[model samples]
Structures are given as structure tokens and as C-alpha cells.
Target chain A: MTTSREIRLRSRPQGLPAAANFELATVELAAPGPGEVQVRNTWMTVDPYMRGRMNDVKSYVPPFQLGRPLEGGAIGEVIASNDPSLKPGDLVQSNFGWREAFNAPASSVQKLNTHGLPTEAFLGVAGMPGLTAYAGLLRVAALKPGDVVFVSGAAGAVGSLVCQIAKLKGHKVIASAGGAEKARFLKDEIGVDAVIDYKATGDSAAALTAALAEAAPEGIDVYFDNVGGGHLEAALNAARPYARFAICGMISMYNAEAPVPGPANMALIIGKNLRLEGFIVSNHWDMMGDFLKELGAWHAKGQLKWRQTVREGIASAPDAFIGLFTGANMGKMLVKLA
Target chain B: MTTSREIRLRSRPQGLPAAANFELATVELAAPGPGEVQVRNTWMTVDPYMRGRMNDVKSYVPPFQLGRPLEGGAIGEVIASNDPSLKPGDLVQSNFGWREAFNAPASSVQKLNTHGLPTEAFLGVAGMPGLTAYAGLLRVAALKPGDVVFVSGAAGAVGSLVCQIAKLKGHKVIASAGGAEKARFLKDEIGVDAVIDYKATGDSAAALTAALAEAAPEGIDVYFDNVGGGHLEAALNAARPYARFAICGMISMYNAEAPVPGPANMALIIGKNLRLEGFIVSNHWDMMGDFLKELGAWHAKGQLKWRQTVREGIASAPDAFIGLFTGANMGKMLVKLA
Candidate 1:
């Protein structure tokens, strides 16, 4: 038997969760049962969507069960396995909980297929984030060559992938990040056509319009929205006639208990024939093979890149998750278990 | 010398329009110039969009030229032609003004390819309204077989075709009309799977939800929205996990000077991964040839049926146009001119 540290949901959070909501407890792990694999957690993702799992409300996904350990995307090393598909020394990714070590049915875990890329990339560019950007932008938004693409929350996990994927798709990509550093990286490093530092921009509407003019000139064809609320309203105003908006994640208003309010310019849609679609990565698993192939090719071609914000220990997962809303991460935020 | 009686915009109106906003002027008509054709208007369509042009506001289609004859969809007999492509006595459809006679380039009129259908059908079933329903429901909604299709303002032209097309496409159609009679017509005559009388139901939300359930045990797949405002919110609440909403018009709140309030459920969109698209039939002209072929085939197959709310005189165009918001017409509203 091995001792494991498990993080359990102590209470349902109201909004921004406090540390009091999570309880760190020690549990004894049993030997791997038939068809089961035991994994030592290596790296786990902390995302804005975690806040939704903390609430009891119904969403596209089922609410996280109370008193249960919250599970998300994670990368780990299988210590031992009774299942023939997985064995010792295999690095894997699983929908595992916030724990140091745990045994799961072999069916529940997949051998992380990094395919020569960094194993941790499974939790970021080659994983859910990759598929979300690929399907939402290309399929839903119908992103085309010379199409102008704008991404909100440009420094976050999914948003960063969206900007990179847009560029790879041969579209003009514009990104908005919190500060000058992230904006510079978006433009100079990532090769995004334009970048807006929202912190430096006093008026978001003016800044957004000016950026659209400078980058798009012709007009925006697709908008990948991660930050909603007022930012979404602003995009609506600046959106070109016949523009398409892909609603991937609304991190800005996810934690609000009350109904979010803003300018109601829905009439613009009628005048412009705009197509706005809301989407989740879960609905797009079928596109993974296509996504991974293209993403890998783009990365190899130097047409795509991604960044990760890493933290040490399970105790830092909550902080990393919360800091996502404050625009702290450069790209995907991961909890690294040493 | 020929004299023609025409309706001209006398002045712009704010809020509810009065009779003083229009003038009946008689003008001497010139003979058709080279490459010109003169059409004697026989049937004119009055649409809610006309009201939007009374005020100086930007719209998808250009605002009505101020102090000029108000133009809309119409069908007429060609009285004179000087162009090589046209001859006299040919029936045609024109985006010509509300007038007795006018000369325009031969390119302005398309020979009404009604395939022996009624000339007035050019303004209704065989024209823009039919294309509006066809393209909006099939192309934008991307409706599939057995999908549960819901249409608001089902008694009107585009909405009526939507119901018929949905039914033809093997969908269970639930339609919403303003009164019990039209609701019954939607069910019994149009053969929609279900109907909701918004006026009698009082609580449109509950009525819509119940109607949706009665028609769609599998849940709603597509919503062709014409009413907008509270109805849009109701549709959002009643939408399935991945429902598609096609915004054809917004008659409910179009006349309001200030934006209508309540039904703030856009958060449902992101939560449900919904797709909402807005389009006008004019932009999809490329699809017209195939659309007319199919629509004519359906009509011959008795799978298509349409009603026209034809006003007897050109002088009654204003009332017929105003009646759209009040739900006075059973189908396409048209004006017959001598």
C-alpha cells in the first residue's frame, strides 16, 4: 500500500473560491485491481472552467458532485498496471482528480501520445485546447484565408491556441492580452498581425476599433471570444457585416452569480447577417485526429507556438486556477507535481 | 404624355407614423429610353422592413431614398421596353417603387419565371419570401432530417415557408402565431406538428416550452425566429443543448424607439453551445435558381402552399405594411395596384 495526498471538495463555492473550500487529506492506495492502472500525478491543468465545476448549477457539462474530488485534464506517470494496455514507466493523461496518486480503470486513462513532443503538451496545445480552437474557428466560424480573426484572453490557454491556429490557417490574426509583454509576444514572436494590450488601452471600444482598422482594414471575418460580458458587446459593435463569432468560453462572466448586463445591440446582427455560435471542446472530440495532425504540422513548420504557466504542488492548483481570471497565465496553466 | 400616380415620402417621421408622412403625387411619365423598360405595377409587397427606412438609420439594405418614391418588391406587366433582352407584354418582378408606372434599366426586372403560377405569386411564394424561408432554414440553420424545428411568427410569409420546408425536410415543426385561428391553421392547414397561440397563452415561455415538448419529444433542434425580443429569450430557454437559431426578422421590437427589455438569457447560448445566425435573402441570390426549381417542384407536388394578404389598392400599402407588426396577415402581405 502507498500513501497518497488527495484534494477533496469541502464545500460548493459561491464565486471566486477560497482555500477553505478545498480539503487536503491523506488516503491509502490499494494495489491495482484487475484492468486498473495506478498513476503518480505529474502535471495537471488549471482552467477558468474549474469555477463552473465548483458551482451546483447545471451547465453544458454536469455540475461536479459535492464532496467529491474535482477532476480535470491531467498528465501522470503510471507507477504500475494490471491492465495490459498500460504498464509501468508509461506517461499518461487522464481525467484524474487533484491527487498525488490514484488507481483508475484502464479505460479511464489514455497513454499520453506525445509523439516526440513534450509529454506535458498533452494538457495544452495537442489536447483539448488544440481541438477547441481548431473546430470552433474553422468549422463553426468558417475561418478562411485572408479572413481577419480576433481573439480575447489572448494569454490564456484556449485563446493562445486560437490565435496561433488562426495564423496557421492563413488568416490575419489579432490578439488582445493584458500587458505589453504578452502583446509583444503575440505580435513579434507568435506572428499575429496585430496585438492590443488591454491594460494600456484606456477605452476598450476605441482600442478594439483602431486595432481592427490597423490589422483587418477590410473587416473582421471571424471573432474567437473567450472573454465575454462587456468585451463581447464591444466586439458586436465593431464586428463587420457578415462577421462570424465563435463563443468558445466566457471566462469574464463565468463566476457572476447575478445576470451579467451590457449594451444590447443584437439588431446589428440582423443588419450584418452575422453568425454567432457558442461551442465547447467536449462537443468536438471527433476532430482530435485532424486537430493533432494539423497542430503538429504547424508547430513543426514554425507556424504555431504555445506557452505554459507552471506551478509546483497540488496546493498551488487553486491559486493557478484563480489567477487565470486575473490574466496571470501566459498560456496553459499547469500544476507540476515533482 | 402619360400620367402616373405614385406614393412619395413627404417627410421623415419619428415614433408612430401619421398620414402626413406620405404624399400621393401624379407625374408625367417619359417614354422608355434606350436600354430602359417601363413597368405598370400590378402587385406590390409591404414588409415590416419598410418602416425601418422611414427613419434615417443605417441598415443592411440601404435606407429608402428620402423624398423619393418608396421602393419594395413588386410584380408588374411590362408596358414598354427599349432594351434588347426584354419585349412588351412580358410579366416581371422588380424591386421597383410603389408607383403606377416607372422606367428603369432592363436589368432592374427579371422576367417572372413563375412557370405559369399567378403573377402576384411573384411577391409571395415565388419570390423573396420563399427564398428567405428556403435559404434561412436550410443553409443557415443547417437543419437535418428528423430535427425539431420551431418558428416564431409562423403565420407570416417567411415563417410559413419555414414550417412547410421543415415538414418537407422530415422535421417535426412547432409554430407560434399570435391568435388561436392562425395557430390552428398552422397545425391543421400547414400540417405543422404543433402550434402555440402567443396571445392566448399569455405566458409565451410556458406555451412555447409546452408546444415544443408536444411536437419534439427529442427536444428542439432549430428555431427560425422572426418576432425576436421576449420570444428570442423564450426560444433560448427552450433550446436544446446544441440548437441552431436563425434570425430572419425582429417584428416584435422593430417599431420600438428604445430597445425592448427582459428575456436576458444570452448566457444560455454559451451554456448550451447554441448557434444564432442572421441573414437576408437578397445576399443569397446565387442560390435563387436552384431554390425556385425546388420550390416549384414542391408546389407541383402539393407539398408547398402559401396565402397572400393582398391589399386592394396602392393607397392601402401603408396599412398593409403597418399590419405586419400587428399580425394582421395570414401569409405574405401584398398590395394590388391598377
Candidate 2:
């Protein structure tokens, strides 16, 4: 038997989760069972969607059970295997997060094709966040060439990839970031046509509208919404006829104590002939092969870029998740648990 | 030369439009020039969308210009024609509405194929509202057989057709209307599985949710939204995973003095993986032939039914339009001006 440390949900959060909401528990793991493999986790992802899972409400993904280990995207190495499919030393991915190690059926985890790239890339640009941006812009938003696209939370994981992908596809990209540093990263590094510093703006919606008017004078054809509320209203006001909005994460409202009121100008959806569709990355697994092919090619060609904000150790996972709502991370926020 | 009586928008309304905001004016009509025809109006249509035109803001349809005649679907007979395609006594459809008669280029008027049906049907069941329902369901919502559909404003022009069509497609239908009379029409005449009288419940959203729970115990797969605001909230709360929402209209918020807050629980879209798309019927004009063929067959077989509230004469057109906001009309509202 071996000892392993895991972060477990202690209680459901009211709004923003505190340290008291989670407990770092030590567990003893027995030898791998039939068709099972023992994994030593290297890296795990903490995302905005995980915030929703912390709540007890029913959602697309099931809520995190109290006193049980929190689950998310994790990349690990197979240390021992009772299954023929996964052997020792194989790098695999699974939804067994906030833990130092885990033992699961081999079928539940996937062997990663690192392809000479860093294994951590699978948790950032080449994983769920990357696929989300791909499927969202092309499939959901129906992005056409030359479409002027505005992406909210552009310095974040999915939003950053969306900006790069839109730019590479010959569309003019306008990106919004929470801070000046993040704004600089988008404009200077990501090569976005325009960058709006949302933190500096007194009225986010009004400022977003004014900035969008100058950046995309013809009006936005597609809006990739990662932040909802005022940003959604701004996009609605600035959308051209037949504009398409890929509704991804609404990180802005995830930690609100009270129910956040939606965009006041939602009637604009009818008048503007807009299509706003919400999607989950898990539902678009079929697009993974196509997404990987395109994204891999782009990465090889030096057309794609990514960054990571790491929170060391499993104990800090809760703080890392809570940090997401405050815009503390510049890119994909992850917890390294070796 | 001839004299015509017309209703012009005297001024833009602040909240709900009133009689004083319109002017009954007499205008001189010129005889048909080359390729022009003089039309004597017979029947005209008043619709909810016209309320948007009363505002000075830009929209899918152009705003009704102050001191100018309002335009909408009108059926008339050509009295004089300079075009070879149109002859005297031929019934045609034109957008020159709220008028007793008008002379326009023959190219601007479409000769209607009455096909032994009432000429007035061209303004209701065979026209824009019918097409709105057809394209909205099959194309926008992607209604699959056996899906449970909930339609708001169920006895109105677009909503009534939506309910009937969904039922014909082998889907269970839940319809909501303002009064018991309209609800009865939906249940008995329209063959909906359930009916919700919105007026009976003071809290529209709560009532709608409770009624939907009882009607569609499995939850709604498709929501055809003709009324937004609280109804939208109910649909959001009651929608199942991967539900599709075709946002055809938002009559509830059309005349709001201040911007109404959207559904507080719109975050449900993300959890349910919902697709809420707003579309205009004019954009899908290519589907007209298919629409007419299907709708005509249904009408011929007597599987489809429609009711019209006729406000006699062109002078009553303003009142007819105002009545739409109050849910006074059961189906398509029309104005008779023979």
C-alpha cells in the first residue's frame, strides 16, 4: 500500500469558496485491481466551470460530492498497471484531479500522444480549453473569413486560443483583458488587432461598446463570450446583422452572491438576427481529432501561442480556483501535484 | 389621379403607442406610369413586429418614419396596370399597408396565387407568420420527432402555427396563452397536449415553470419563444439538456419604458448546453416554396386551423396594432378596407 494526498470538497460554496470549503485528505491506495492502473499525477487543471461544479445544483457535469476528491482534467504517468492497454511509464490523461495520485480502470484514462511536445501542453493549449476555442469559433459561431471577432476574457485559456485562431483564419480580432499586463500580452504577444483593458474602464459595457466601435467600425460579426453580464450587453449592442455568439464560460457571474441579471439588451438578439449558442467541450469529443490536427499544425507553424499560471501542490487548488473569478491568472490556471 | 386615405406615424411613442401618435391623412395617388400598377387595398395585416418599427432605432426592418405611412403585408386588387404581367382585377400582395389604396411599380407587387382560398389567408396562414413558424421550427430549432415543445403566446399568429406544426411532426406540444378563452382554443382546436393561462398566475415565470413541470414531466426539448422576459425565464428553468430555443419575438419587452432585465437564470443555457438563436423570416425567404407546399397541404387536409380578429376599416388599424400588446387578438389580427 502507498499513501496519497487529495483535495476533497468539505462543503458546498455559497458564492466564492473559501479554504474551509475544502479539506486536504490523505488516503491509502491498495494495489491496482483488475483492468486498473495506478497513476502518479503530474499536473491538473482548475477552470471556471469547476466553480459551477462546487455548487450542489444539478448541471451538465455532476456536482462535487462532499468528502470526495474533486474531479477535473489531470495528466499523469502510469506507475503500475494490471491492464494490458496501459503499461508503466506511459503518460495518460484522466478526470482525476486535485490529487497527488489515483488508481482507476485503464479504460477511464487515455494515453497521451505527447508528439515531442511538453506533456503540460495537453492541459492548456492542446487540451479541453484549446478544443473548446476550436469547436466554439468554427462550429458553434460559424466563423467566416474576414469576420471581425470580439473575444471577452482574451488573456484566459480558451479566449487566448480563440484570438489566435481567429487571427490566423484571416478575421480581425478585438480582445478584452482585465488588466493592463494581460492586455499587453494579448496585443503584443497574441497579435490581436485591438485590445480593451476592461479593468481600466469605469463602465465596462459602455467602454466595451466605444472600443468595439473604433476597433470594428463595421460592427462585430462574431462574439466569443467568456465573460457574461455587461460584456454580453456590449456585444449585443455592437453586433452586426446576423452576428453569431459562441456562449462559453460566464466567469464574471460564477461567484456572485445574488443571481446576476442577464444582458439588459437581450431583445437585440431578435432585432440583430443573432445566434447565441452555449456549448460544453465534452459534448464535442468527435471534433477532437479534427481540432488536434488543425491546432497541432498551427502550433508547429508557430501560429499558436499559450501561457500558464501554476499553483504548486494539491493543497493550493482551492485558492487557485477562487483566484479565477478575480482574474488573478493570466492564462490557463493549473495546480502541479507531483 | 385619385385620392387615398392612409395612416402615418405622427411621432415615436415613449412606451405603448396611442391614437395621438398616428395621423389619418389623405394623399394623392398618380395613375400607373410604365411598369406601374394602381392597387385598391382589400385586407391588411397588423403584427407584433410592427411595434418595433414604431421606435426610431434601427432594426431588421426599418423604423416607421415619422409623418410617413407605415408598411406591412397587405393584399389588394390592381385597378390599373402599365405592366404586361399584371392586369386589372388581379389580386396581388404588397407592403404598402395602413392605406385605402396606392399606386406602385408592378415589380414591387407580387401577384398572389389565391388557389380558391380566401385572399385574406395570404396575410395570415399563408404568409409571413406561417413561414416564421415553419422556418423557426424545422430550420432554427431543428425540431426532431418526439421532442417536447413549449410555445409562448400560443394562440397568436406565429405561436399558433408553431404548436400545430410541432404536433404534426409527432412532437408533444405545450402552449401558453393570456386568457382561458385563448387557452381553450389552443387545447381544443389546436390539439396541444397542455395549455397554460399566463394571466391566471401573477408571477408568470413561476406559474409557467410549474405548469411546464406538470405538462412536460420530462422537460422541454424545444422552446419557441414569441414572448420574452418572464416566459424566457420559465423556459430556461424547464429546458432539458441540449434544448434548442428559436427566439422569434419578445412582445413582452417590445414597449418597455426602461430596459427590462433578462432572465436571472440565463446561466442555465450553459448547464443545459442550449442553443438560443434569433432569426428573421425574410432571411429565410428561399424556404417559402417548401413552406407553402407543407402549409397548403395541412390547410387542405383541414389539419391546420387559424382565427383572425378583424378591426373593420383602415382607420381602426392603429387600435388593432395596440391590441396586440394586450393579447386581445387570438390569432392573426387584420384590418378590412374594401
Question: Candidate 2 chain A: worst 10 consecutive residues by lDDT?
Answer: A200-209
Measured by TM-score, the strongest candidate is 2
RMSD of model 1 against the true structure: 3.0
TM-score of chain B of each: 0.94, 0.98
Write the residue-wise lDDT of candidate 2 on A232-312 in tens digits: 888999999889999998888888889888888888888788888888888888999998998889878987779899999
Q: Please report, as a residue range, the 10-residue window in candidate 1 chain B with the lowest summed lDDT.
A: B258-267
Give the range where candidate 2 chain B is weakest over 10 consecutive residues by summed lDDT.
B200-209
lDDT of 2: 0.90
Error of 1 at A288 (Å): 3.5
For candidate 1, please provide the TM-score of chain A on its own: 0.94
Number of the top-ranking candidate, with DockQ as the measure: 2
* Candidate maximizing lDDT: 2
For model 2, the superposed segments whose C-alpha errors exceed 4 Å read none
TM-score of each: 0.91, 0.97
| Runs in model 1 lying further than 4 Å from the true structure | A58-60, A168-170, A200-217, A261-263, A297-304, B13-18, B55-59, B81-88, B202-217, B259-263, B297-304
Query: Model 2's CAPRI class?
Result: medium
